[model samples]
Target: MIHTRALTKDFTVGRGEAVHAVRGVSIDIEPGELVAVLGPNGAGKTTLMRMLTTLISPTSGEATVAGHDIATHPARVRRRIGYVGQGNGAGHTQRVHDELYTQGEIYGLDRRAARTRADELIEALDLGALRERKVSDLSGGQRRRLDVALGLVHAPPLLFLDEPSTGLDPQNRANLWEHILRLRERHGMTVVLTTHYLDEADTMAERVVIVDHGRVIADDTAEALKTKLAGDRLTVGSPDVRTLSRLAEALPGARDLASSGERLELRVSDAPTAAAELLFAARDAGVPVTAVQSHRPTLDDVFLTLTGRSLREESSEVSK
Candidate 1:
């Protein structure tokens, strides 16, 4: 549904120094696929989206979105895809239903068609109660749902969401995701979204693309990336901390060993087998084991493995 090659975007500041917002990023997204783009603040994932959506021109390279060249056929691309940006796209004074209808008309739908689309979206996104309410009066989650409705007013085949669930609480986030998934399934839309929520990206998106310093650092299915880059993690607590650390250090396939208090944690290729071996070795050495637990690798682990930093910490800093 979308393809890019060496897509680059640069900006010049007051001192004439160039800022490389997006540098040589090349990626392909297939139709009917839900892909999540992840990165820290100023990582250029948003820049890449803007270029693809025709909101900004790329400094270099080329892209085709929804079967049209983004550079040469921007209008066609816009017609074929919907974009819901980080900020609410609805006007504050407008009624919820009015906002959706207006957006449809702006996209060239006639009055009747726009109204029909507005009603369809209101029913689909569960905005019936707020149909007459002003956009400003809606809560954060309500406003976000309206924003999604606005983007889908045109019924585009592809949709681009830029952090659609940034500030909502857990329930609202899950609600919004449910609506998004239902809409995608109903319309057969190709979804490409950027999110700071690691768990959301891991569980919701079929594919994950990690961007850093304006480059595409990693791209694969979330599970594949985790399994290939970061294996399972083991957390062990023992009364004999010194002996447990020594034994854990010598375990095969172990990496990133860490210790705190009486607990030690490490990443290994196989956590179940590694934990078993460590427990037996500790038993033979007469080191008492208190507890042992193993966990599957998360998307943040994949980011840390690639960039040597925590994605959660970086995202929190960006929020700050």
Candidate 2:
């Protein structure tokens, strides 16, 4: 479990300009819950995670992890939470098994206990074939799994994952999801993960928090957020821009409309009613509509409606 109140982090850049990475974020995560923090790069999700894991101190506010005060009992919080960051923690020269054994020892396990945990994690993470291989020789996905294993060898009650699926292919991503679900269902571990993938959050997280510009934009169950954007979308293709505008105005509950060369997209609050009206208006206007399709709102749609930009677009912009 985790709790934070008015958590804020600030850094002074050159010339006294302050970079507020995390600003006044307050959240409470219950035990055995999977919470996903969704955000674009530079949106402060990683900053918040780092503060919660005791990697960095907040400029002002209070936080507790697993009932231990982050500022007063950082060591206790660290012992109770396992953190798998974006970067690989294993040394290139170390073997896979040796890496985990070292982690166990650092956690205060004796030689026998460390070796036992190392072997157990190696088997559980399906790294038996590569146990003798050096970390540098492993693929990206393998290294990521090894990182997760190292974080879990001590069996912490809480886990923090920062983009755990980065650089992994579809198959490996699915495999990682299975491992994460097992940790929650079998071990009752509490998980807080930050990812750019909406599908991952939609599938794995019991609750979702969307952050942007150092602020919490939305927080709710994935289903509830999608329901908030409930409705139908109508897309029509027409060569004439004026005709597209006319159709958009004729459709009720249409908030946003986009026109491309012979294509028009509309965000409608009511799909069935708007669809019928759009067809009739097009027929009356004598504009040749090539195709018409209606679809339910998705997480992407909700994100766009809330932020005025797509999540992928925001991510690409941030990377630049």
Top candidate on TM-score is 1
What TM-score does structure 1 among the candidates reach?
0.96
Clash counts for all predictions: 0, 0
Model 2 C-alpha lDDT per residue in residues 185-287, reported as the tens digit of each score: 7778999999998888888899999998889889999888876764567777777767667767766678677877877777787777787788788788887
Pairs of residues clashing in candidate 2 = none
Residue 247 lDDT, candidate 1, scale 0-100? 93
TM-score of each: 0.96, 0.89
Estimate, for each residue in 120-189, the C-alpha lDDT of model 1 and write its tens digit: 9999999999999999999999999999998898889999999999999999999999999999999999
Report the Cα lDDT for residue 305, model 1.
Answer: 92
Q: Give each model's whole-structure lDDT.
A: 0.93, 0.87
- Model 2 Cα RMSD, 1 decimal: 2.6
TM-score result, candidate 2? 0.89
